[model samples]
Target: MPQIVCPACGAINRIPPGKPAETARCGKCREPLFQGRPADLDGAGLARHITRDSIPLVVDFWADWCGPCKMMAPEFVKAAQALEPLVRFAKLDTEAAPEAAAAHGIRSIPTMMVFRNGREVARQSGAMPAGQIVQWLRDAVLALGS
Candidate 1:
């Protein structure tokens, strides 16, 4: 069983094999497991998603004042929409959670990191188009054999 931490209530959930995750609801809060968009994360939320999600987690570390970050926002949403239920998408506002950014050694905005089993496997910086983002993650996840 794959364990997924609920983006809504932060409850760890396990979906039984053969269950369709797109229509699955959280066992605790009953919120849909995959919302087809990035879940906004603060420090604790980032930690939860990084450490608890069984699926590959793609986190965009960005801020309000960053132009590239803003440009990548919709592209990220498109990637999320296309990849959900297979990969979990999230966003961490570096402005709101400076501690988290510092902890991760984020020296620049628009840094994207992919995590699997609580460990970071790949990272990229700067903005990219939706197609590139989706392809990057697909290749990364494929390389990880996840």
Candidate 2:
């Protein structure tokens, strides 16, 4: 079983393979931590979670108003569903996490950042299909030789 540290509320959640997202809960906040998709994160929390955790991270910076962003949302969710134990996926709404977006120098919506061992390894901007997203994630992991 692998663990997913919640970026939103800082709950270290142990998520076993095949575990239904409906049952996943945060130990600290006792909130519905896993929503069968990437957990949205803010600036500080996003930094903390990415640095503290050992697993690779994929972050999507998006906003509600962006049309391309909305198109990418489902693909992100699907990627999250397929890439358990290998990668951790998260989302940050630029509207809500403006500081984070600025800190990361996210000039556009649907920006994807891939981090490994607390360092950013790759970044891409624009909307992509599910297969392409998965390939990009695998490429990032392969680059790390992990």
lDDT of 2 by residue, 97-145 (tens): 8988998899988999987778888999999998899998887675666
Q: What Cα-based lDDT does every candidate model obtain?
A: 0.92, 0.80
User: What tens-digit string does per-residue lDDT give for candidate 1 at 38-96?
Assistant: 99888999899888898999999999999999999999999999999889999999999
The TM-score values for the models, in the order shown, are 0.97, 0.80
Best by TM-score: 1
The backbone clash count of each candidate, in order, is 0, 0
Give the C-alpha miss distance for residue 102 in model 1, angstroms: 0.8
- Candidate No. with top lDDT: 1
What local lDDT does model 2 show for residue 57?
83
